[model samples]
Target: MLPPHRARRAAGLLAAGTLGLSTVFLGAIGTAQAGPTGWTFSESNSPITVPSDVCSIEWTITGGAGGFGDTNLRGQNANPRIVTTVVAPGDQYTLVPGGAGADHAAGGQGGTNTVGQGGGANGDIATGGGGGGAASLVLKNGQVFLSSLAGFGGGAGGGAGGHVPDSPSAAVITDFATTPAPGVAGPGSITGQGYACEALNTPPPAPEISVVPGPGQLSVWGRSGGPLGPGPGVAPVTGYEYSLDGGPWTTVPGGATHGMATPLLWLTGLVNGREYGVSVRVTSSAGPSAASAVKKTTPFERPGKPTGVSAKVGPSELTISWSPTAAPGTYPLTGYQVWAFHGDEVDGFQVYLCEVSASVHTCTAEVPAGVDYAVYVEGVDDKGNVGDYGWVNSAVVPLGDMPATVPAKDADLVGASGPITTVTAGKTVVLKGSGYMPNSTIRAIAYSTPTELGVFVTDENGEFEVTVTIPGDLPAGAHSLVVTGVDPQGDVRHLRVDVTVSASGTATVTEAALATTATATATATERLPNTGFSAAGPLVAGTAALGLGAGLIVASRRRPSA
Candidate 1:
């Protein structure tokens, strides 16, 4: 057979109309004018017939880069070329893009797109030089019409000196090949050249593996190096596979099969806090190698519950606080959740009060007044798992006398006294005051028994509004409530109010009046004061004697007058 270059040249001559052969038929009409169309040819060994109306073509051709070397001596890259040339209508042409050089033994030449020079080789002790990259070419009549020659790669010990294109963006033609194709021939054995190496038959060594635990998941990774050195294997590793608890092997995602070197593989849907055994192996054409030594890890779920949860009653709001000692599981702590429950434990309903970030220790929520409630706190993990609730307050009956902390000021008082304010025993009553030391704690005491009620804090204006419940067994009578706190000047401050305590569980009387009528009777008298009976008898005898004397005198006077 003729040499490769000579045969190509001879073929070109026959197709160019030089040897009286026309591979392309021309129209009888005169040369055609320019037409509106662009042509891009990329396939190797393929032909393109010039359009009947297109008189010329602006061609931009790119060459492929040389193959990568086994060592520091890399293959050189090829430069691209752009040219504008006149063409006859119906002329046949072929586009051949350059192929990348290969690092295989026997010094394989880059394929026909570009005629790459073959690489040189060493014995099994060292790898062979990468094949040189080929130049892109446009062929006519089997001859080279337009060609961009790329530099040959270094065979073994030398460095490559290849050229790079100045106008890479101007290239319109895609190169055909980057690596060697099937059945392509390598350089023939030459005298004094060492024997070429062959494909490996042994599988790759097992890889070193590690795992990180997450909530219900595990992240796994592997790298070359175990009982063997970093060389890993006699053959190229295609991928890696893993087995869980000695189960069937599963391929690692994004491994060499997906063109990744060392990808992180995740095992999900695992049980939290359960120990799992895992092993890994490398895969190659020879099949999977022995598994690596088993490693164990346990996945963690949500964090432990929070501690020291406490809720302070303040008017209609509860000031909640907690400790974060156990707020995070394996993951980071995200926040805390507060819940308020009303009624008894068996039948009550709960309300989501508020949520505060892990960094904050306190949260305030407005709640309904006068009801007994229990506040619960829980930790939230970054994975969105809420831990068990921590019970700080089991029976917190919010009263009207509870007040929130405020800033300190001067000594003062409010509603000291007025019309007797009536209050029922064993019920909540709101009392407001001002002018104590701001943000100071105070106590309310009920008299005349002087029994202590509850403690509270003042507000920024040195004011306070608190709820207090009276004692159930206190006798029904007038009483007073006194609140005492520290003044701004460190003196004791006191506020007092007079109140009438109704009978326990009863309403107080509202009216006050007096009655002014006598309740005595008189006895009847029988006679005049002293000597009553003798006086009556003498008066009667005198009346009779006087009548007798008067009759004798009248008889004597009548005789004289006659």
Candidate 2:
């Protein structure tokens, strides 16, 4: 009674619904038949297998139970209700179970003939016995995630040993929680639980550190507090951080090898005489711990040497001066040392003359006259550190009173004898002189252009003879010679002389003559004093001679005549 097309469509829809229901029923039945497998850990380790069809698994893990001890001191319970998730698991895995801690025995009474029992060989005798920590549970060949508080185990109390007269009874000690069973796995959802889970995700505990003064003022030591133990759950301290004088913190890269007994870190480079505050902290994968208490210290160092040293010579004292040292601010200069030593003498000794304040750079010290002296200066710091000596400076002091200037009348200049008035250029002239300071130096300088000709030292009697060569370049004319003398005390005397220069090769000499005439008158005024026939005799003789000469002339005339 229905249409053919409509009836065929309705029948097709009903068949499809029936097939869908059957498929769902078969899937449910299969799932119900394949239940989750269970496993218990009796040995230290065991193997676990996952079903091939299973895609994920939920795990509940707990640590082993603790042991019992005397004085009602019960062992601690294992970590409880730890939940974890494993995704995509179809392979074998290894499971490790924790072992329970051992129980402690109480001490027995001591007496002769009856041995007394020793204290329990577990934990401290007075305090409750300690419980062993739980081992970690690791899942392999599968992606596993743990909830908070999944790895921690409680610690056990110490057992009471021998009873003491005044001490509290051993029964007063109370028991802690009992240990828990090992972990189990099943096909179920894994959800994080408990307040401890939230705590486990937080950063690890910070380490404790202490700093001590080292051998040198510039050095310090950093010590780390040993391993912090609350069970296997807490992370260990890995490295350290330090700061000096309120400076930025510096981190040490490597972790400590000995937990609480880590070696001390030797730090250097601290400035001397400077106040410093140091601090340190611990670090781990979870982050860094808070900074430790600050430690204060001061350093010391030697000062630098002084520079720019100089010495000024006086009649009886030496004035030493120097520039301020470029000392560091940490070790400021406190004073200066002035030393005097004999020139060219190193007897391993020096004269420490005096000390001057830092504000002053110069000092005066008395010295013997006529002696050469070498001087040095050094700087001293507050810490008793002395700097090296500065550069050496030398000076000589004058000895005695200076001689007076020679008077022109007291000195003379004379040339070698015959007509030696003239001199030629490039010829030697010998001269002599006296009346100068004995044992003094004399210099002969030409007047023209003030050129030096020669030098000589006066002998014991203050007299000298010197030969001087007229310079070829000297003008051929008259010139003056200036002579000077210098005594030991730096006094000066001078003398001057005039001389002429000639172009002729030889010296010329000249002579002059004188003539006289007399006349007489024949007046008989108290006639001339008696002379032995002088006047008349001379007249007669002259007449006779004349006659003879006349006669002879006549005869010659006649004889030229004979």
Candidate 3:
């Protein structure tokens, strides 16, 4: 047989013994016999080709960086005559491809690799996933779908000068090998991930902030995060602020020490209730981060009860209802809401039943019958303020039904999921003042109860809005709530809630049953008034105040100044 090197010679390629060119596979294309190491090639590699087109080059795929940004394998340094375009194989990435560090400076290295593959030409970032070289691949017929694992390595990035092992089995093409088909060979590797040189001191994997793990510190899993030495230009990580269950956001102290390293929990803090997300801002004492990843955490909150609820009796043309807001408030009474599981009542519920001075306990809705539905109600004060939905069970309603009720006097009722029954304060929180008459509403000062932090006054829709930053200096401990809501009719609504504030400034409200919660945290929140709650200091907005008053005081209070 002709010598393996001489068996597949093509026009314009370096013949054997010229330029130290050796025979190597170029991923999906056939092989070219050049010298020992001078990149033996016949022609440039196209991103794709027609199945009927002749196959000529060799091909190989390398692993790529794990996170978002792109990685490139520069072609400038490759055999100048050979043009290559790398098609990320499986879950590949290509950020700032080619060049040593960036397009602005340096050129990339060449070879096969995987996570952490291709390195910066200057070794600015870590090596590509497989440490394998990258090549841009062109799909034939345009119908090939790459595996999720097919990732892009930094294009010929820099600093990959060390001895990295390479695969030995590459297909070499003769003028006759691809006559019947296009030049391509694959369906090769069998795993989603692989690596070339795996002995380096890898950093502790970065922490994951997805909804699955429930945000906060200690959410470590996947990739890299810790004390491992920094990878090129990595910014030193300090602490981070995060949110939970989509509540207020605040940053705190804590992070891995390796500077310039890739940390999942990098710059941003955790937020509650919403799908988590992050952007690692690399920083050095020299300055802030230059390269950032605008990536959102994978959301994994459990499915909630079917939402967008409305009720109709068909006979009265009355449609009673409520909405399940994504707002981060406590249950039993999210704002002015009251709820009962379906089928708990034989009759539908009435919006209002009792009416007395100062107290709304007499205000109850009768449960309708025949149809399965939950019931709830929000208390509206005389000043037009609405309270969280309070629970009532004067009667029960079954599926597809309605019950009878004798007419009660002068009570106005709106059907709904209810109202914002209860919400605990963050170290600092926005006070939602709604539902009060324009000029007649009370100040946030009067409604400032701990368990019941009064927000802004109501609007024309009887809904008011206010953004009050909860101070971070309040005492940390398990506490209860007491709030008062005045309506347009001058009636006051009372509410009681409970919460816990950790020493590190993590605030969480407990459920009505007082169950310990692992979610819903607000770092900075204002204190609600207790019986002796002395009006502490005046409300100073936006300052990071870390000290609270000597004692808890009640009204005759100091108003929170805007």
Candidate 4:
């Protein structure tokens, strides 16, 4: 049917008869009509997008090969019985099973049951519709292909042209009974079977790729196939894959040579020249199929720089090897490396081709063979790229014994960060030291605090450091640090550390009290203490001697005193 396009193209078109198709390769669901034919049958194709559930229009009825056996056949139908009914949208249907009534003898050729669909030949009463050839169906979209009506009419021929297609009327008729009567001579005959209700989709599998050659190994090839016959419009595709260089693409297994045979499958080793690329992907469960053209292969090529290099002296130790830099013609080498130098102490070498790819010259170690070392070698190619220029000096391998004395914090050893005992004035105490044979004549002196005790000197990793920040109060708390380690063979080592003088003294309030001067002084309490608690007791000295002995005498004069 092909019309309402919302995204439905799962295609298919392989026509013939019996209408029975189901291969879920998807592509299916309504709309199809193909019931009309006269002759010619080359097995048509090209209409494939079947996977949408697979149900566009499927057919296979073919059977027009019984005409050469003519017995004056008219409306042939010795006993043809095919009654499929269902017709609305404008009715119409017929079924005339009444044809073999006179000297009958034509029907028999629907072998293997109904293999290629063709068997209905025995009807020659004198003239009338019965040649057998008109009734192929394909209505899927809305469905409708009517044509089948052979009622009693053979006074001159004996009808036979009703294969019920849009059909209807005849209701239900499967009558095939005729053995001895009506014109006699040849009892019965009639055969033809094929169908198609709608359903055709099986096309999507054709991808390819190839490249074979493996000893060292490099092989890859494949292809996959599917739709060819089940016809409709666009059906016939096959593809496979293989790629490199840019890389990434592989698929091919027997998708479609169109017919059927084997396919292709193999992948090994790979790299031959360099630029390896390929592509192919054509698929049409019923639609897209067209994209192929892109292939390249150098698989081999490269001739130059990469040759003999050896070194394995032993005294101090050195081992190295290399070869394959001779490309006069056939190029094929993938790795080698070895590099070392002592007088100048060089450093570079290690290359093996493919996988870890790096090995240009040569390398095998064990120079501890005891000292004197110097070596070099390199090589690689197969797309693993590796070569960073290597070969430094100092390859001197006297190994063991001469490398242990550089320890005192070896940069060369020469430390002198002061006898920095206690420091925290300006806060810059960091006299670290480092020195190595830099002409090792190092020096560092930084003493700080009191009597202008502050100093700083510098040298190298033989050891010399200076970060002096302790110059203000030389006499506060704990302070005693001195470090000096030198070696020009004078060999003097003295380093002590103890510093803790967090002393910061400042406090003054001379004699302050002047808000109103007299902080508080109302000492009038003496009024009661004037003479009470101080008495020796004894009734206050007998009441002060009876008030001065009763002032007796004084009374004598005072007559009233009597």
Candidate 5:
């Protein structure tokens, strides 16, 4: 049970609340003091929730009409509005309607108060003008749809004595179909509805990204965005954004579009042997697409130097050993190279002994006895990178040995006579020896000088015979001949012969001259044995006769004997 004017005000407040225009009405109305009555709507209602199926929407909205008044104080018209656009569902929006203006309060009556028991007459007071209405708006999908300006309220009637005329309201509202326009200063009223939308525009798909790793960088490429169904409405891709190792994304310049080729982008400053994860996304006029899948890769480098190189020397052989080197990248060690050098000369000729597998750490090389050598090793990786040589190792081969039992022997020298210990300058001598290593080399040399007399190989019995020509210019003195034997194992043994040489040999009878004198004596002895006289008497008689005959022959030759 409320007054008619109050009930109408309540109904207007409810309509403003339904359109979300209560806040604007509160601001438009003045303070509710004794001065004048001002119009106001209720508080704003909850926002409208759009359905998910809806893609586009159309809206038609109007502002509140101005309040009514006397002939001189007519109210203004309401604001006009309209909107249409594409939108996404599940979005919330607000709608606002204009509030009506309030009428002015009535003027107060004139009164007389007692002053010294005599009443004083006072003039009638005029009332203030009404307040203006507030503007309104309709928002769809977080965007403005239509708006209206405020309208002014009517003025109060004139008092009894001071006749104050009512003020006129603002003019009628203009068409706000194109854009939201403000309402005039008049009564507040609204009339509009929302319409269903058409189909929504399709978005582009996510890009496919790939990465290729090089020496210290990575190459990235992508493919995204294509033409729509049978029309010109093709989603256009502008560029791409990339993230490294789950870091912040960085935008690049180019991207693949409909009926276009994709380009690669090279990124540098990457560390070698490090793995990286990368992702990409494409951008278009609508918005950005989802991120692509992660791509993994790693940069590579050469292997490092080997370690723990060592060499062991055996008789006529060298054994080398070392540890395998490590690679800094994904490549694995493939093999090892073993090398040998003469001495400390590394840059000289390097003898490539052998190539061994990565698992094998040792290798052997055949070398000459009693020689010095230096060894080195290197590692090779699957990526074709050769590591530096390891530390140098010195190796020395040990000497070899000959047979035993070569020291003592049956050593003797023989000349024309049997077993001569001494010899003249022009005499020829024969040397005989036994108890030497079988199939070994035997050498006869002059002990005083470096002259080699003869060289021979021992027979199966370990015996050798060699003819040596002693130099005629050899000094006439005591000299020693050295006989040496060397076995297959490179062992050595020596025998010495002491001999004496005379300065002169003119009176010495050689073996051939002695044999001739002996033959003549044997013939004379045989003739005496045939004559039957006593062997001594015949020989004595013959000797005496030979002496007498020789004396007579001499005399006859001297005296011419008959």
Candidate 6:
């Protein structure tokens, strides 16, 4: 007998195709070794005879091919088996290649009574099963040397092995019989026999999904693939699977309504302003359909409020400016919205000043004067989302908010009586005023309890004629009508007319002292009468007293002595 090390060396040389070295070891062991030879068998029940000079044999065995099933359900192929066995001269062995299974028939037989059975069939519909591979066995003087049982073929629409298929094992050497070990089932081993039949139902087509983006979140809207297939076995979508950014899939139950698109899922815990890819697949009893086309969207939030806001005021125009806000996300910043509130915070009126493009940081708007305003700014995204307002500056009174002059030095007003300065109380009268800013807005105000009567726009000659109605509720007292406007130099110009207010329906012209007190406690509000004047053109650059004949005409009314 050869030493154990020499025996191992012989096996290693034999596996490496070193036949000369193996022959040396075989000669040392007193056995003449034959040159290596390979054999392939496809037929069933073939016999293999070991040469008289051989000491070992290497065998490679393969199972037979599986049969095909109807509706393009092909059977799985078998796994190959390989082993090297120590043998004596003139050893006897047999090769039983499993027979190929036929469509709608029983599976091929394996060595030692192992068989792969076929699935059930209905009329012309059939399923196939694959054949089992040959087994490996070696016996010396009734003592076991190495043995491996053959594996059964796969069943139709079942795992790679046939239904109830037995497992195969690698060759082992022992004095007694070696039990076969279990293995993971081949492809399709866990499936039912009806797995192939379910293919009659068509898969769902790729769907069109919509996405609405929000702050660090995305809302996906989708619809069902609908019922599909030609026969009664038509499959309805039972669930849906979604993937985000090409990540793992998540399954969600399907709704009852089909074909109509609606919000179905919301993906959160995402970074803002980052784009992500999304896909969906519909599932049914038949399996999952092909994935839908990829759609991309980005989550975003409203822009930050503008900072460092400031404003500069002119006669009736305000120019506002601010610093840039935070950078935009998926939705770009479209513009900035500027707003202002007139008067004190308690009773202020809000107004939308203007909108400026995101590329710009400044904008100008037309604003009414005579009252203080608080200016604010906010950012707007491309999706029309508005941000919080940045209250930068307040109490921005325009240049037209100067003190009211009791009797303007460079302005004049005349009624139908031609410069005669007597007026009745609680009556309607037409008065023409000149010597003011060209194309400027003029306000008729009643004071000591300042009340706004009407507003009018001056013509190109700095003149305007407006019909005025004295307030009927005014107590019989001395009062003055102050016509205020902005001059060409952007200075406030007030034209005052002093008069006595009498009771209604009485033309009693009472001679009263000139009212000189000017207060801002205005309480009465009235609508402006419609003036039949077209829009004024560009303002003419001239003095406010251009048409004044003598510049100062003091009309004094005296009561005649009875």
Q: What are the models' TM-scores?
A: 0.27, 0.22, 0.20, 0.22, 0.23, 0.33
What C-alpha lDDT values do all the predictions have? 0.49, 0.41, 0.27, 0.29, 0.43, 0.47
Give the lDDT ranking, best first: 1, 6, 5, 2, 4, 3
Better of 1 and 3 by TM-score: 1
User: Against the correct fold, how does model 3 do in TM-score?
Assistant: 0.20
Which lDDT tens digits does candidate 3 get at residues 1-562? 1121221112211123211112221211111122122222111322222221222233332222211112434322221111122222232222112111222123222233232333322333443322222322212233222211222223333333212222222122221111112222211121111112112122222332321122221132122233333443333333433443344444433443322222233222433333444433322333333322334543112212223434433321123344443332211211222333321122112222222232222223332221223333333323222332323222212111111211121222111122222333343333332332222222233112222234223333434334443444556766543323333332333233344667776656553422222222222222222121111111112111111122111111111131
Instruction: Give one clash count per candidate, in the order shown.
Output: 16, 17, 225, 168, 18, 7
Superposed on all Cα atoms, model 5 deviates from the true structure by an RMSD in Å of 50.1
Q: On a 0 to 100 scale, what is the lDDT of residue 280 in model 5?
A: 80
Model 4 gets an lDDT of: 0.29
Which one wins by TM-score: 1 or 6? 6
Q: For residue 207, what is the lDDT in candidate 6? A: 47
Candidate 6, 1-562: lDDT as tens digits: 1221221101000022222313222222122223454432322423444554454455443333344444434444544444443454465554333333343344333222122222211212223343433333332333333333334444444223222222122121111222223332222110000001122255444445666555667666665433322233334455678999888889754542332323457677878778899998776666667787888977666667788888886655668899988655346788877766543322234445777789898887665553345676767777665554566444333333323434443444445444425555567765565655455467777665766677666665556667788676777667667677655443456666566655552333333223322211122223232111111112111111011121111111111111
lDDT string, candidate 4, 379-415, tens digits: 3333322221223222322211121111122222111
Instruction: Provide the global lDDT of candidate 3 against the true structure.
Output: 0.27
Give the runs in model 3 whose Cα sits over 4 Å from its true position: 1-281, 284-287, 290-336, 339-358, 371-562
User: Higher lDDT: candidate 2 or 5?
Assistant: 5
Please report how far candidate 2 places residue 131 from its true position, in Å: 81
Candidate 3 lowest-lDDT run of ten: 551-560
- Candidate 3: Cα lDDT at 453: 34
